[model samples]
Target: MAHLLFRLRHVTEEEAAEVRALLDEQGFDVYETQAGFFRLGVDAIWLADTRQREAAEAALDTYQQARLARERDAFEQARARGEAPTLWKRFLAHPVQVALTLVAVVVIALLTLLPFLGLATP
Candidate 1:
């Protein structure tokens, strides 16, 4: 009997492509289709003859687990910040912060060459 193995709905095209790549890597004849407002299909329909369901499941489980960990860390950081966020805001908050940071970094390199140029304070 032909059985439905797995079904997945992707929120975006890039996610769908990544799912397809994983399925392909596991040697499954992967295929997909677009549903309304999303992509839904047999992203990794397993063949009975191939019998690789375990490996495919492991790969997907690992992928989702890593994604969850990343999202959780990001959520914790956002909660700590409270609000008024965005990396750009944090970066641009202090006037001359960007220029001063670059200047300080350049000073380290200048110090390395100063002895040769006789510019070292004696």
Candidate 2:
């Protein structure tokens, strides 16, 4: 029986390719499945041999740790250079969009709280 090894949903193409290459390099017998038109199926990698699960999992864990470290280092470098994205930066980049979003949020919150506030008054 095949065991699910990794989920591909929300994973970037570059990350997926790297994961595929890593699995292949590790000599794991694996297969990939795609979510169909209705998205009912899972998009994932599966290991054909259950006996290799532990080894495959360990390899994946190591790879993930390395990737996480690399991403953190990149973010740290960006922050040091004052290039990392911040809320203020985002608002500056798209002021109108940000203002609209804030308005929508306030409207939603007021609508949600209005009934409760009326109950408190009585």
Candidate 3:
């Protein structure tokens, strides 16, 4: 039976390619599945040998940890250099979008609380 090694949902292309390269380097018999036309199908990497599942899992875990650390360090460096997009930076870049979102939020909040406020007032 084939064993699912990794789910590809929300995974970046670079990350998926890196994983594929890693598996190929390790000589694991792996294959990938597409999400299909309607996107209702599975999109994942599968291992042909169930016996190698543990080894594959270990390799993937190590890769994920290293990737996490590396990405975090990069993010920190970007933030330090003011290259990271903060909330204020986003707002400044797109003030109209920010204002529209704020207005929508206030409208939703008012709509949600109006009934409760009326009940309390009566």
lDDT-based ranking? 2, 3, 1
lDDT of 2: 0.98
Off by over 4 Å in 3: none
Against the true structure, candidate 1 reaches a TM-score of: 0.45
- Writing each residue's lDDT as its tens digit, candidate 1 over 16-81 gives 566667777767644443344453434434435435666666777887788779878898888798
Question: Listing every candidate in turn, what is its Cα RMSD in Å to the true structure after a full C-alpha superposition?
Answer: 16.2, 1.2, 1.7
Which 10 consecutive residues of model 2 have the lowest summed lDDT? Answer: 113-122
lDDT of 2 by residue, 50-110 (tens): 9999999999999999999999999999999999999999999999999999999999999
Where in model 2 is the C-alpha error above 4 Å?
A: none
Q: Can you give the TM-score per candidate against the true fold? A: 0.45, 0.93, 0.86
Instruction: In model 1, state the lDDT of residue 24.
Output: 76
At residue 91, what lDDT does model 1 achieve?
68
Poorest stretch of ten by lDDT in candidate 1? 1-10
Q: Per-residue alpha-carbon lDDT of model 3 for 1-122, expressed as tens digits?
A: 99999999999999999999999999999999999999987899999999999999999999999999999999999999989988899999999999999999999999999989999974
| Cα displacement (Å) at residue 71, model 3 | 0.7
Candidate closer to the true structure by TM-score (higher is better), 2 or 3: 2
